[model samples]
Target: MSATPNDPSTPNTPNTPNTPSTPDASYLVDGLRFAFGTLTVVPVRVTRWDREAARGGMLWAPLVGVAVGAAAALCGVVLLALGAGAPLAAVCSVAVPAALTRGLHLDGLADTADGLGSGKPAEDALQIMKRSDIGPFGVVTLVFVLLGQVAALAQAYGDSWARGALAAVVAATAGRLALTSAAPAPVPAAPAPRAPS
Candidate 1:
């Protein structure tokens, strides 16, 4: 005897009113699995809890920051210990954290600068940020940011590479967490597009 339309175990048949979605199937489950797999890298946990977890779906930016910073420090150590050139070490040190975090904070910095830098109304400022191009204010801010990082790394000195590593851990985590805590406003789903400033 064959199972009727009421039988959910059947395969390749279009689900109808008779059969309901399974409790186990869900987007949230898939997302959670993906997030755990990407962030914590625990393959076991990924399978344990699932649903297409994109963005790494981190619960806290500070944890992400500390992890990124530690990774950067390790990269720095590798370069320095391997006798890589000073420039190479410096570049790698900076890049490790930047790349590890996938540059979200930097984008935040750039956008915030763009929005606030524009003298126009708040809506217009936000529009400037959505655009692909950067304004003069953006360029200036980027330069200063680069310079400041370079200066900080340089000032960290040979003996302080370890401290630089610690600082990275402390600074990124503390700063990101602080920003997150301070953000009282709710995020809008989408913003109106506007011409570049």
Candidate 2:
């Protein structure tokens, strides 16, 4: 009888040379690229989207926050240097982060609020969130949140420019750090068991 492919009598053919799965960049660089690509309007090319890359990205997310916050702070400081009022500076600072993120963070917040406020079954609530238009709940949430941020920043800026800039940086960094801490790390799947001969 001819030897079967899986039989010990059959010799194994040489396998093709192994290729690298990840890009040439180091793991840390891949993580930074993923973090910036996802979190900001910065034009970073993400080379990997695997679980390992995501894990690294999440860990590096706070750095993106730092950059965004610095930009916001700079806008506020510039406005102040131009002799603009504290409220206007606050508004511009608030707008800078929103613009940099392409309003993604605000959109997510609004969607989440709408979904929770629907008070329907999980499926229905999810559908409400998926709708393109903002709901009443979303509108109210966005208004109040934006108002609160503007007010707080105005107060800080009225006190001192340095205080306002520091607040923006601290708040942005804390928000990103919170998200990173809340996210669950990706777990590897267990290998499947082989059947007995």
- Scored by CA lDDT, what does every candidate get? 0.58, 0.83
> Positional deviation of 23 in candidate 2, in angstroms?
14
lDDT of 2 by residue, 1-197 (tens): 86643244454444311112333346678778988999899999998886556666887889989999999999999999999999999999899999998999899999989999999987788778888899999999999999999999999999999999998888888888987897675343223567998
Candidate 2 off by > 4 Å: 1-25, 185-197
lDDT of 1 by residue, 57-154 (tens): 33344565677667766776677778764455556667776665556556667777888888888778877888877677777887788667756764
**TM, every model:** 0.61, 0.80
Against the true structure, whose TM-score is highest? 2
Candidate 1 displacement at residue 41 in angstroms: 12
- CA error at residue 93 for candidate 2, angstroms: 0.8
